[model samples]
Target: MSITFEKLSYTYQTGTPFEHHALQDISLTIADHSYTAIIGHTGSGKSTLLQHLNGLLKPTSGKLVVNGQMIDTKTKNKQLGDLRHEVGFVFQFPEAQLFEETVLKDISFGPKNLGKSETEALEIARQKAKLVNLPDDVLEKSPFELSGGQMRRVAIAGILAMQPNILVLDEPTAGLDPKGRIEMMEMFKQLYEKEKLTIILVTHNMNDVANYADNVIVLEQGRLLRQGVPTEIFSNPEWLNKHHLGLPQTTAFALKLQERGINLQELPLTEKKLAQKLAALLQREVK
Candidate 1:
């Protein structure tokens, strides 16, 4: 499934004293099975845009299409729920939403709500629990009894149980340690490749965009500032700096080396590539 936003604008509390414009004339297309990252600072429309993906918010003045459903002011509320089933939305700190007595029940909630039989839901629950690398024993335990990281996995399992074609993650790795964050991102990448799942990630972490996303969208003050591949967007240090953004650590390091008169042909986005380039330069100097 794909998504297209056409001159989309959203206003909260329209016609009220507290009206705030969240998005303004945003236009973009997200192709099926692609990994796209949305980047912006606080209050820059990232959160508002994510809500529009699953029909949680209606466009106030323009058209937005998801899969095949068109959304605008005229879109009926009843038709929106089906889109939620197709898009697995993992909000920031999703573990806080877990409330069922057992982890199995919590994971099974989405599928069961979608009208799956109890047996069917249980089967999916088990499968997704394994998919997220949760231990089989955890199913019988209370989700509240697990560690924070384990609780996170359980929340993710709930979304996977619905078998969404598109996984929209909003800061999915907010409060984890460095190791936990790396592992979580790797798991998402695996799912994107193995299941052909379309991933739309909203994050401030430039490293995530550099290492994973094929494309990036820049939102500034409720407007679309730029949209391009990471190399194109992050390569212009001046522009990123002007917008209060920075490149991934590897890319930034390469840029610094270039400024110091090193001859790195291109910026590297990952640690391994950066190490390899530095090693090759040293070897050539020795020879």
Candidate 2:
């Protein structure tokens, strides 16, 4: 399903004395089955925008159509139930939300809440748990008894059990080590490719953005700064630096090589590509 934001704006604590504008006249379309990344510094409304994907937060001024559901200030809470099921959100440290006595119960919670029979929900949870690589023995164990990373997998499995078409992730890998981070990202990539899930990820990691996202959205102080593919968005190191944003690791390294007079036709985003280009240059020089 596609999402279209039309002149969307949102305000926090809308009335009274402490109102703050979090989004302003944002217009964009997220294509079906695409991986899109939202990037910006803190307080840039990235989290605020994620809430609107499933009507958790209604637009204050304009309207957004998410999977055919129109959301505005006037849209009733009752109207959002189905949309909520279609757009599953995994907040930062999602493991903190786990509360059931057993991993099976926690993972089956969403499906059960959606009115699935206990047997059906448990079956769905079992499938999702395996999909996340959780061992069968983990199902009967308390989620709290598992390691932090395993707990996170159970939380994500809960969302997957709902079978959301659009999976929204907010800093999903915030506190993991380098190895853990890569594993988490690769799992999401598999879901995107194999399950055809449309993913919207909010993260500060430029490497993740370059490696995974097909498209990028830049938000600045609650306004749209730019929206484009990874190449277009990361093309201008100077522009990104001006906004106090960093480039992918390979892109940064390539810029340093350029300063030393290396002729790269274009900057490479991934480590493998950058290594191949440098290797080819060395082979030509030796010949």
Candidate 3:
């Protein structure tokens, strides 16, 4: 299902003295089955915007259409249940939210709550555990006994068991080591590719945004700043710097080369593309 924001805005503590506008007049569309990244510094409304994907936050003024439903201030909480079912949200450090006695029970909770029978929920949990790369041996163990990475996988599997069409990740790789981060990211990539699930990633990692996202959205102080593909967004290093944003490592390296008058035809976003570009430059010099 596609998502569209129509001049959407959100406010915290709407009427009181502390009322703050967390999002303001944002408008954008996230295509179905696409991997999109939302990036910005803290207080830029990235998290506020993400919550709207699953109806956790309703638009304060205008409307947003997601999963064929229009959400606004008037949208009732009861009506959001089905929307939440279609969009699984993985908050930052989701493993901290696990509470069931065993890994299997933890993963099976969502399905069971959705009315699946015990047998059906268990079957779904088993399948999702494997999907998230959790071992069968871990299923019977207490979730608290597993390593942090394993616990994270179990948490993700719980969301997968619900079978959401759109997976919303808010800094999902936070707190993971470098290797663990890569594995977790690759899992999301495969889910986006093989499962054809729409992935909405909210991250501060420019490299991941450049490497994984088909499109990027930039928010600034609760307002829409820019929206484009990674190339277009990263091409303007000066602009990014002006806004206190950093480029992908590859893109930053390419920018440095350009400063030294060794510019490529275009900046590369990933390491492999950087290698290819450099090799092509070498080949020309050899000729």
For residues 1-287, could you state the per-residue lDDT of candidate 3 as single tens digits?
Answer: 68999999999998899999999999999999989999999999999999888787888899899879889889999998888889998998999999999999999999999999999999999999999999889999999999999999999999999999999999999999999999999999999998999999999999999889998999999999999999999988889999999999999998889889986979999999999999998999999
Model 1, which residues run further than 4 Å from truth? Answer: none
- True-structure lDDT of candidate 3: 0.93
lDDT of 1 by residue, 1-287 (tens): 68999999999999999999999999999999999999999999999999988888999989888999888989888988878888899999999999999999999998898899999999999999998999998899999999888999999999999999999999999999999999899999988999899999999899999999998999999999999998898878889899999889889889989999999888888888889999999999999
The 10-residue segment of model 3 with minimum total lDDT is 51-60
| Candidate-wise lDDT, in order | 0.93, 0.95, 0.93
lDDT by residue for model 2 (1-287), tens: 68999999999998969999999999999999999999999999999999998888899999999878899889999988889889989899999999999999999998898899999999999999998999999899999999989999999999999999999999999998899899999999999999899999999999999999999999999999999999999889989999999999999999899999998778999999899999999999999
lDDT accuracy of residue 201 in candidate 2: 99
| Pairs with backbone N, CA or C atoms under 3 Å apart (clashes), candidate 1 | none
List of clashing residue pairs for candidate 3: none
lDDT score at residue 6, model 1, on the 0-100 scale: 98
The prediction achieving the highest lDDT against the true structure is 2
